[model samples]
Target chain A: MSSKSTTKRADALRSIEAIVQAAAECLGRNPDASLSEIARAAGVGRVTLYAHFASRAEVVDAAMSRALDRGNEVLNAVDLTGDPLLALERYIDAGWHLVDQAQALLAAAQRELPAGRIRELHAGPAARVEALVARGRAEGAFRTDLPIAWLINVLQAVMHSATEEIRAGRLNPERAASHITATVLAAFTPPGIPVPEPRGGA
Target chain B: MSSKSTTKRADALRSIEAIVQAAAECLGRNPDASLSEIARAAGVGRVTLYAHFASRAEVVDAAMSRALDRGNEVLNAVDLTGDPLLALERYIDAGWHLVDQAQALLAAAQRELPAGRIRELHAGPAARVEALVARGRAEGAFRTDLPIAWLINVLQAVMHSATEEIRAGRLNPERAASHITATVLAAFTPPGIPVPEPRGGA
Candidate 1:
C-alpha cells in the first residue's frame, strides 16, 4: 500500500516478466532443457529464481500465465456485434495481430504445452466467438451441427497451427490468417448459404 | 519385380513404422534420448537399423514420411466434387482423423526439424485446400484478401495442436475438431454469405 511496497511489487512483477520472457526464449531454442539453464537465461541466480518461484514447474506455470494473458487480451477485444460472420473475421484478425507480438515464445510454449491452461486462457476470445457461432446457428447463419464448444476447440488448434506456419516462413502471416478464416468459414457455411460480397445485404 | 521383392518391401515398410512408433514412445518418455536406444525400442539391431536408414535424421524423416503418407491418403480420398465447401469440411474432418494417428512422432520430429521438407511433401492437401479457397473466392463465397497458401499453413498448425490436445486428454477429439472447424470457418465465410445447410446433400 505504501510507496516502498508498491515499488517493490512493481519490481517483482518486472522480474517475473523478465524471467518468463527468458524462459520462453530458452524453450524456443531447446524444448528439452532444465530449470537451472532457464534461470541462467533469465540472468538471475538459482536462489533468486527459487525465491520467486519454488520449482521449474512453478516457473513454467507462471510463464504460461503471462503468455495466456497476452493471448487473451487479443481474443477479448474482437468486435462481434455486426454482420456476425464478418465481425468474426475482424476477431480472427485481432488474434493474429496479438499473436504476432509474442509469436516466437508462444509457438514454443504451445508446442511443448498443448493442453496447458495457457490454452484455456487463450480460450477467452474463443468464448465470444462461440457466442457468435451460436447466434449464427440459431439465426441460420452457421451450421447448427457445430455445437458451440466444439467449434471453438477446432479454431483454437487452427489458430495455433497458423501462427507456427507464419513463424516458420512457409506462409505470410496476414495472408495465412485471412485464408484460414475464409477456409474455415467455407467449411462450416451450411450448404446453400453463399457468402455475400462485402457490405451487400444477404 | 518378383513377388518376393514386393513382400520384402512391405515387410521393410512395416518395420520402419514400428521403428518410428518405438522412437516416438522413447521420445515421449525421454526427450533427449539417442538413436541406439531408439533402435533397441524398435527391436532392431543397430547395424540393421543403419542398413535401413543411414542416420537418426533419416530414421526420423522416414517416420515422418510414413505419417505424411497417412495424411496424404486422407486428403486423397476426400471427395471434393460436390459443394466445394462440403468437400472442405470432409477434408478438414479427415485431417482431424489423420493427425490423431501419428501426432506424437510428428510433434517430436517437428520440434527437431525446423527446415524439414515435411510441408513440401505434405503439400498435396494444401494445394487442394488452396484450390477450394480460390474457388470460394471466385464464387464469392470467401474473401479475396485471404491467401490460399497461408490458410493451409494455419489450418495445418491448428490441426496439429488440436490433435495433441486430444492426445493429452484436455480436449475430446470430436469437440476440439468441431470447435476448430467452426472458428476457422467464421473467419473464412465471406461477409453476408449464406452457408447452405441443404439437408441430405453430402
Candidate 2:
C-alpha cells in the first residue's frame, strides 16, 4: 500500500476515535443530545459523522461500548486482593466514579440498544462482583445464608439506586461512595455478626 | 332513564370491568401477550375489546392501572404498626406477593407508558416505604448515618433485584421474602451494631 493511503487510513481512524469520545461526553451529560450536537462537539461536520455512523442508535451504541471499555479499565486497576470488606469499599469507590461518568450514556444506551445487548455488555463487571462475593463467602467475610448470585445482585442494585438518588439530588454526590460502601458492607455481613467499619470509619 | 337503557348501561360497565380484569391477568402472565389473547381471556370479541381500548398501549395502561390498584389493596391490608423490624418483615412478605403478581405487568407498562407516568403510579408504594423508614430511623431501629431517602431507595432496589433473581431462577420464590427482610435489616442496622435476626431467624 502507498504511504499516502496509509496516512489517509490513520486520519480516518483518528476521526472515528474523536467522534466516539465526543459522543461519550455529550451523551454522558445529556442522554437526549442530538447528533448535530455530537458532530459539533467532535469538531466535525455532519457529512463526516454520517460517513461513519448511520443513525443516532449506532452512535449511541459506539459511545456505550467506549464507556464500558473505560469502566473495565477502571475496575481492573482496583486491588481486590485484601480483606473482603476493605476490598469491597475500594471497589465501590472506584465503581462510583465509573457510574457517575457513564450514567447518562447508560440512559441513552437503554433507549437505543436491546435490553439483552446491554446486559451482555455488563457481563464483565458482573463477573468481577460474582468472583469477589464468592471469595468473601468462602472466607466467611460475607453472608452465606443467601445465594451468592442474589448477594451480587443486591450489591449491584444498591449501587444503581445510589446513582439514582444522586441524579435526583437527594444524595450528596461527595459522600455517595462512602454511603454506598457502608450500606453494602453492612448488607453483606453475615447475620449475628457486627457490621464492619471501613478503613476511615463510616 | 328507561329501564332498558339502564340495563344496557350496567351491562356495558360489566363488560368493561371484565375486559380490564382479563387484561391484568393476561399481561401479568406475559408482558408480550397480544390484544387477541386478552380478548380471549376476557371471553369477549376483538371488536368489543377494541371498542373499549383504542390500541394495545391503551389496554396495557389499563391493565397496569388495575394491577397497581390490586397492589394498593394488598399493601393497605398489611399492619405496619409496632416493632419497626417486624413491620418491615411483614411488609417484605406482602410486597413479595405484590411483586410476583405484577412483575410481568410492570414490564408491559415500561414498554407502553412514559417513565414519569409509571413513577407517578408508584408514588403510593414509595411513600409507604419512606414513612416506614422514617419511623424506623426515629425509633433508632434503623441507621441514621445514611440519608433516609438513600436508605429507602436501597430497600426498594434490593426488593426489585430479588424479583429479578426469582424470575431468573437464581432465587427460590418461597425463600425470597425472608432473604429480602434479612438483607435489608442488616443494611439498615447502624454500623458497629450486630445485625438483628428475623422472627423465624435468618
Candidate 3:
C-alpha cells in the first residue's frame, strides 16, 4: 500500500537475505560459529537478527535449507539418463559443490537439528543415488554380489572420503572428481570383470 | 604399607574397573547416556561414581581408552603377513567386532573428547590400514592410481558404512565381513584387472 510501508517491507526482506547469506558462509567456515558472529558477518545488530530467527538452531535450519536449495539447482541440471557409468560420473562432478557445502554445514546441522530432520533434508539426493545404483545393477554395470544398499553406501562413503582427503590436504581439489570417479567405478564394476579406467583425465 | 590400606586400594581398583566397563556398555548403547545412568548401570551410588570420575568427559575418556585397549588386543592377534588380499580379509573378519564397538562409542567420544584426541586414539588402527594399502600397491594387488591416503580412507569409510547398514537393518551382521571384503577388494584392485571374488561365504 503506502510507499513508506512498502519501503520498510523491502528493507526487512533485504536484511533477512543478508543474514541467511552470511550465515551460510559463516557456518560453512566454522560449524561452532556463534549467533553474535553471524550477526557481525551480516552487518546487523543482535536485535535485528533476533527479530528474524528465534535461536541459533533456527538460523542453522535456514542456512541448511538455502544451501540445499542451491545444491538442488545444480544437481537437477545433470542428465542422469543414458549409460549408467557415464551418468554416475556426471552426477559426481555436478554434485561435488553440494557435497562440499553439505560437508561444511553438516557439523552445525548435527549440533542444531534433529537427526531425522537432517536425514529428511538429504532424502532427495540420497534417493537419486539409490535409483541410479539400482539401474546400474539391473543393467549389469554395477556389482550384483553385494546388497544394493551396501553398494549405495559404498558410493556415498567414497565421495565423502574424497571430501575428507581434500580437507586433510592429502588430495588436490582439482583432481578429486577424477579420483572419485576412478575409485567408485572400479568398486562398482561387477566381480570377474576388469575394473574400468578412470573416466575423465585427472 | 598396612594390610588394611592394601585391601582398600584393591577394592578401589575393582570399583574403577566396574565403572569403566559399565560406562562402555552404557555409552555403546546410547551415546547420550547420562552420568547417573552410567552410575546406575555400574551398580554404584552417585557419590562413589563422582569420587572416581570428576565429570562425564572423564568417564567417556576412560571408557574409550578401555575399549581401544580391548580392540587392540583383537586387532593385534590378526596375522597381517602373506597375501595382501587374504591378509585383508582376515583383518576385516577379525576387526569387525572392534568396528562394531568403536562405532558405538564414536558418538560419545565426539561429544566429550577433543577432535585431536579422538584422531590420536584412532591413529594406530588407521596406520595399520595405510601400511597395508601401501604394501598392496607395491605388490600390484592394489591400485596406485589413487593416493594412498584416499585408498585408506575409502577402506575405513566402507567399513563404517557397513556398520551403518547393519544398524539401519538393511544388512545382516553375519554378512558384513564378506560384503566389506568384496567392496574393498574391488575398490583397491588395479584398474584393468578383474575385481576379486567375495572371500569367505556370506
- Summing lDDT over every window of 10 consecutive residues in candidate 3 chain A, give the lowest-scoring window: A95-104
Q: Encode model 1's per-residue lDDT on A92-201: one tens digit a residue.
A: 77776766655655544555554555556556666677788778777776666655545565556566666666667767655655555665555557655675443321
Task: In model 2, state the lDDT of residue B103.
Answer: 87
DockQ of 1: 0.38
Model 2 C-alpha lDDT per residue in residues A112-155, reported as the tens digit of each score: 99766887788888788778888999999999987787788888
In candidate 1, position A156 carries an lDDT of: 60
TM-score of model 3 relative to the true fold?
Answer: 0.87
* Candidate 1 wrong stretches, greater than 4 Å: A1-43, A54-57, A70-83, A86-90, A111-114, A123-125, A135-141, A174-191, A196-202, B1-42, B47-55, B67-97, B124-145, B154-165, B168-193, B198-202
Per-model TM-score, in order, reads 0.67, 0.83, 0.87
Candidate 1 docks at the CAPRI level of: acceptable
What is the Å distance of residue A160 in model 2 from its true position? 0.8
lDDT per residue, candidate 2, B1-62, as tens digits?
99999998898788788989998988888988999899998888999888888999888888
- Alpha-carbon runs more than 4 Å astray in model 3: A1-15, A43-52, A200-202, B1-12, B43-54, B200-202
* Number of clashing pairs per prediction, in order: 32, 0, 0
Docking class for candidate 3: medium
iRMS (Å) per candidate: 5.5, 1.4, 1.3
Give the chain A TM-score for each candidate: 0.73, 0.90, 0.85
Tens-digit lDDT string for candidate 1 (B38-142): 888898778767778776767767666666766787688878766655666777777777677656666667656655476665677668788877777787665
The residue-level lDDT of candidate 3 at A71 comes to: 80
